[model samples]
Target: MEPAADASAQSTAERGRLLFHAGLCAGCHTAEDGAPLAGGRPIESPYGTFYASNITPDPEHGIGGWSDEDFVRALSEGVSPDGEHYYPAFPYTAFTKLTREDMLAIKAYIDDVEPVAQPNREHDLVWYADWRWPLGLWKALFFEPGTFQPVPERGDAWNRGAYLSEAAAHCAECHSPRNLFGAIIDDVRYAGADAGVEGGSTPNITPSKDQGIGSWTQDMLAFYLEIGMDPDGDFAGGAMAHVIDVGTGKLSAEDRDAIAEYILSLPPIER
Candidate 1:
């Protein structure tokens, strides 16, 4: 019989499976018609086309050899086991806010998944971008490694929303504009961005009366996330539609409401 601790670990891993869906990890790591977590999805960026890495348990080609500490470092510090710097394209900057417990849970869940024997693809980069050493400098300038810190003055729901949006879900990766170095502009977060999504621009999710989602009620936002339906009865399309299907749609009603509440609490931005 399985030990009690082992059974508890399994249950925790199951919860982490849901967290993985909410984090949209599968969306980026899964290639078109490819085995899930086998990777090879081409993410286009200003600098180059980055192929997502395989996260399966394949010993030769995936993260099967990674320790829990190794996985945590990769997610929170953007550093691989071999000390290589991961490009910001992986969004580890935002992932840095995840707690160690959540990170371990994610690792446990990944361990439970079937291994795929797919090899990783090299990134297609612009000229003069062959070296990865520059990423260290980038991290120095913009990255702040830490877990999400709740504001003491905020309510539990608001804090939960902040944690989910800023850390777990990394919503700013798509909605916020980036600078020349591909760093998000902190001052104008969630105001909208181009080139963040494939083929089309990411829309403003801020609360500005114009251009942003200020007119949207918290309930409306929650409904949209849960079902991809707008207040006008129209269904969402494109990448957002997929996000709803794979990510937010899996969230519990309480979590969805918390996300909405936190989003609505942000200062309004017009652009």
Candidate 2:
């Protein structure tokens, strides 16, 4: 039997909530103790430090005055509220894979949220790094849109895993290495990453026996996702711990399992 409209709407909203956490939107956007989407957090990077902009419903600083298209452009196109190019540090590249409906739900949830009047912080960058147009062109060359492509032969759980990794969770954005211009080197896949809060390397997550988690049990992977603790009792430090504490911690157990299943299926690359 078909579900009722109210039930469907509730389900959609609940899914929107799930996606928000799975995507780790609040982890970077808001101060650790602040409200959702209020957007006054700092993002440290090798290129330069950036501050998260206000995403609340405030007309001035937040996105309260934004139209549907405006929100869509910012998320999928990496364009700012005033049409300036946003740095890839915002992770719009990963968010680009969300379906229109999913994006709309997220936007709706943001609109329905309370607004905070926090001012944004400025970036500390070199001269050439200030160019926004170049970033736009770079996006044009590498960025692709629309939702995750489903493998028809894969089960629904596996497809869900793909969606989380490719779109919402955006594992590749961090785990994958980048080229000279900071664009992800797709050829390397998940070989490893050099970007971390303090200049440490993100370990290769491929199924490689030596360089990656080839020996990790499926249960351990799921547990790590939920708690950020490894089998050796080692907890992830720096920004990764932040991801675990906020993002993955909010995900459902089933969803975390899906991510593990999809990750286990990737090619085992020697790092």
Candidate 3:
């Protein structure tokens, strides 16, 4: 029989699995009609097409050989075990805010998945993009590695919402406009942006009634996350539909409400 600690570890991994879904890792990593986390998804960008890496437990092709420190470094510092800098498309900028405990939980869950013997695909970058040394300069200019800090004045729910939205869910990566360098424009956060998945537009999620989601009640937003059904009788489609299917739709009721509360509390922005 397995030891008590083994059972406890299994329970922690299960919680991690749910958190992984909430974080939308599978949505980005899984290719179209492909095995989950086997990773052949082609993410389009202004620079070129970048493929997501295989994160399964195959030692030769995936993260099976990675230590916990290796995993944390990849997420927190955007550095690989061999000291290669990862491209910004990985969203390590947002992931850098995750706590060590949360990072380990995510790793534990990933370790529990079945190993796939698929090799990682190379990126189809623009001309003269073969070199990775330039990423170091980019990181120096834009990347800020730190954990999420809760405001002492805010209540637990508000802080939790902030952590989940900013760090785990990385909502702004899609919702905010980016500069030429592909860095998010901090000033216009949640105010909507172009260059969404497959060239679609990401709508304003701010609290402006004229342009954003201020017309939505907290319940309405929560319901949308839970089932992708808006108050207007519209259902989410496209990339958002996929997000709802694999990510927000799987969150707990309290978490969905907390996310809505945090988003609705944002100052209105007239995008």
Comparing 2 with 3 on TM-score, the higher-scoring candidate is 3
Which regions of candidate 3 are displaced past 4 Å?
1-7
lDDT of each model, Cα atoms only?
A: 0.90, 0.82, 0.89
Please give me the total number of clashing residue pairs in predicted model 2. Answer: 0
Better of 1 and 3 by lDDT: 1
Off by over 4 Å in 2: 1-3, 32-35
Winner by lDDT between candidate 3 and candidate 2: 3
Better of 1 and 2 by lDDT: 1
Q: TM-score of model 2 relative to the true fold?
A: 0.93
lDDT tens digits by residue: candidate 1, 125-218: 8975668999999889999999999999999999999999999889998999999888999999998898786646898898898898899999
Which run of 10 residues does model 3 get worst, by summed lDDT?
191-200
lDDT comparing candidate 2 with the true structure: 0.82
Ranking by TM-score: 1, 3, 2
lDDT of 3 by residue, 50-100 (tens): 999999888999899999999999989999999999998888898899898
Clashing pairs in 1: none
